[model samples]
Target: MTEMVRDNPALARFELGDGDALAVAHYRIADGAMIFTHTEVPRRLRGRGIATRLIAGALDSARARGLRIVPLCSFVVDYLERHPEADDRAD
Candidate 1:
């Protein structure tokens, strides 16, 4: 769908959607790394690939920022397993 995911720095998350339908990938930046801690897609929004797009965009943003990725969230870890091309970015 080419949804435009954006980083909400004040909230420490990569966000997609607006208002009550928001989907987010939460993270913390430290020591040149972006540590992903959680991901959430509204129940109504599940099964529509929203989380995939959100994570992909978040990883891309971290790469652009020259930050390594630390996927602490189970969702992120699973994403890495499913997308081996992203392996190089994770620690």
Candidate 2:
């Protein structure tokens, strides 16, 4: 099971750990926007919707903070493209 998404601003990433493996979506605030920089889900954790969840967490956080989003990561952009729910949240 995925734990609640937690922000580690010092590292600029939202962490989703599943005991042994971890998934993360990174972001940085710039020019009043949250720029999503990267996303990584351990190979073993692929196809489990972990990246999707991580992206959701990141985007949700951005919205909660009332920040625009500049998705620098292709994965994040693609994910948003596929999921309109998140795409609508992008800025």
Per lDDT, the best of the predicted structures is 1
TM-score attained by model 2 = 0.90
The TM-scores, one per candidate, come to 0.91, 0.90
Q: What is candidate 2's lDDT per residue for 1-91, written digit by digit as tens?
A: 8388889999989999998888988888977788988899899889988888888888888888888888889998898889877663343
Cα deviation at 12, candidate 2, in Å, is 0.7
Model 2 alpha-carbon miss at residue 61, Å:
0.5
Candidate 2, RMSD to the unseen true structure: 1.6
lDDT of 1 by residue, 21-65 (tens): 999999999989999999999998899999999999999998888
